[model samples]
Target: MTDTYADLLACEDLLLFASAAISSTGQREFHSGAAEQRLSLEFLHEYVHGTHPDLYALALALHVNDHNAAAIVHRLLSNPRTGASAGERARENALIRRRLAEMPPQRVYRLFARLARERVNNRRTRATMRAWIAARPNLDLDAVKYRPGLRAAARHARVALPEEVGVFLFSPPGERRRHRYGSPLLRAHGRAHYSASDLYDLPYTVAEGFAARHRVPRGVFLEGVRERATRAERLRLAGTARRHGVGAGPDPAAAPLLRLCVYVLSLPTAERRDRRAELEGALAASALRAAGPAAGTWPRTAAVLDDSYSSIGSPVRRHHPLAAALACHHLIRALAPDSTSHWVSGHTDPLTVRPAGPTHLAERILDALDTGPARVVVVSDGHDSTPPLLADTLTLWRRYVDPDRATAMVHLNPVFDADGLGMRPLSPAVPTIGLRDPRTLPSLVELARFGEGRLGLSDLREHLRATADAYLEAP
Candidate 1:
């Protein structure tokens, strides 16, 4: 079971879903009965009771209304043995609050009132409730049983209590409160539900208004808004967010601008040149640059980045693979400033290759090996379009360049190989490591340390144990 967990962690296709089952970091863009089946309460409970409560917290966030989830929440709230720290509890509550704001107004009121009754009043929780209530002037505050306490607390804290909270919570439930306007949180959620095509036509003011009204951190919601935004609207949103100190609306790991870059790169050569500056600037501003090499004697490493058309994918390409490749290229350059030994797509220059061609892993490997570097690393999706000669090239590289059979080549796959069950290695001699997140570039350094061969089970276990211990030890 533990081995399965470890393998799932390394499996890109499963990791996010697995991670989401236990943690809030998982992608919840698609929420349906089918998606719910991917994460079971039993699995969540086990993880919640295990070393990674953060994972379960995320799962709970997604399945907050589930009976099993509610039970786990009750258990966690009552017991300290769930492995959740003070910080983790606070984070989960905050996530729940944000999710509540995205739900219907009546649902939000019910959930908030339930939490208030249960006394789950963290600072962020109270503040979020206050923000929602402040935005909705027509809500019946009497529905909230703890209205008096909340009102008193707001008054004592000199917080701006809603005018309707003064009227309805103090009056009978039969007499409903009326207002001049509707619920802003519900309105925001409504605005957020616009179809992709419909979103482009809506004025940017709608998005800005939602952002201004909602205090809860709706990053995922904001990201969706930016995704459907027009080029002009995207730029406008970015500039507005910066001015308002909200930073970028989208996740930097899979930023919309990066996808736009990939889209622009796919255009005709003459057209692509026009957007090169924008593409380069966005890449530079991303979190990838921070994964720069440490100050030390770097190894003689050659990195081959895949900028193939397959890497960018079809329909909705997040450009994550291309981004990871660029990140690796930047990492290598930062570590070994003097090393000009790297390839992207067919080009030897990493920056010159746009994601526009078919994959030729054999050619890239041969090119890198020809340089006689101590280590050859290929960053690809393992979807070689040219030929099945990658293994032959690895064999040749191992035979001539590395007669001692030292670690000659390593394949770092940014995209998970669903059919292969795990990351695919070109040959038995050459091992593969999953590069789901660019922050794991340090793992590349660990591979560099394995100067003579693949990492064994013991080696992998030791790394996992250390990681588990470190996460458990963190506050």
Candidate 2:
């Protein structure tokens, strides 16, 4: 393949002077002293021979006979940009004046023409380079070579990368990428080839550059490919694919899944308008909070995956999704502590809900009541009262869900108050639906435990309320 650009480090730079000198007729005058003086052909030859400006001038100076002239030309050309220091330049000019006074003009012209040819070579190289630029294709995956493997696949793939790249692992079926990491087996014995189409992938292209910079040979650990990939770069690279169906749109919302004990509670009064307003309001505030100068924050959206937050946290910084997720998580935890570990993982983003501590209690309650969504009977201390709004949330869910498929998911905190009062709600008539005084919640749990068959909704609610009342009225 033809080289597309002439490395300025190597050639076209010299052509600038050659073109100028070939067209000029000397005895050109230059200022060697404070005043201008006519330069002898030989003197001029030493000053202009091989380098850009000098080469052209030397061509005009009849510099062919001067072998040493190239050396002087280099000396002046290589010196600092401000031009040579006064003392060194002055002495050099004196020596050139002596030689110019001795050489014939015809001999000078002959030497000048020869050196001009050297300058022609510079132009020729550039012309060739321009042609290459006009001909070569854009860099693509065909450029990279990977090892062969049966199950090579991109795992930590980034959608929009500033550069195209694909990271894959070679392993047996069902073995996660972690097992196949960039170990020597995958690097050597495994087989996977970098297809030209992979150049369209953002992460893969980035990895190529990273590999080149760090001197990492191909087929290395797939981790390095997407490790430092940023969200901005991913967004930019993916934009093209999105427009052309290259990749799916990223989920900017997958962030709220991080907090532990996260509970989403829609107020009992939540209507379509109210729910819309609440969600939108949360998003709006999230936007402004992230608009500040120091806004990057990624939370563990997945309950068990908080530590893995860094994997996507660094990239999420550019888009501010991390902050938004944190905002949602912060608000939701005040609602539901039972279903916190569950989250929705999607193509656009992953959602994390926190896991509450009393999973064991919740499990025991579920095992006992498999018939329907068990009614939740929370018995917690006054200090840990379940919010009134959250209490109604379970009732609201039961309205739409099948009892057999639903889970009451109770959080029973059986503890006495400072005044030695029970924590269960004393009456359903009390507008505030907080946990019954913690001491009284036990009677309700006990009633459910003694149930003959699956507790019907009305009966279960009645018994649970009576137990709360009895616990409260008891001395």
Which candidate leads the pack in lDDT?
Answer: 1
lDDT of each prediction vs. the true structure?
0.49, 0.29
Q: Which ten residues in a row have the lowest lDDT in candidate 2?
A: 149-158
Query: Model 2 reaches what TM-score against the true structure?
Result: 0.17
Q: lDDT tens digits, residues 190-276, model 2?
A: 222233223223345435553455555443423333333444334344334344544343333322221111112111223323444
Candidate 2 residues lying further than 4 Å off, grouped into runs, are 1-251, 254-407, 411-475
> How far does residue 319 in candidate 2 sit from its true spot (Å)?
20
Each candidate's TM vs. the true structure? Answer: 0.50, 0.17
Model 2, 274: alpha-carbon shift in Å? Answer: 25
Q: What's the distance in Å from true for residue 89, model 2? A: 93
How far is each candidate from the true structure, as Cα RMSD in Å?
11.3, 36.0
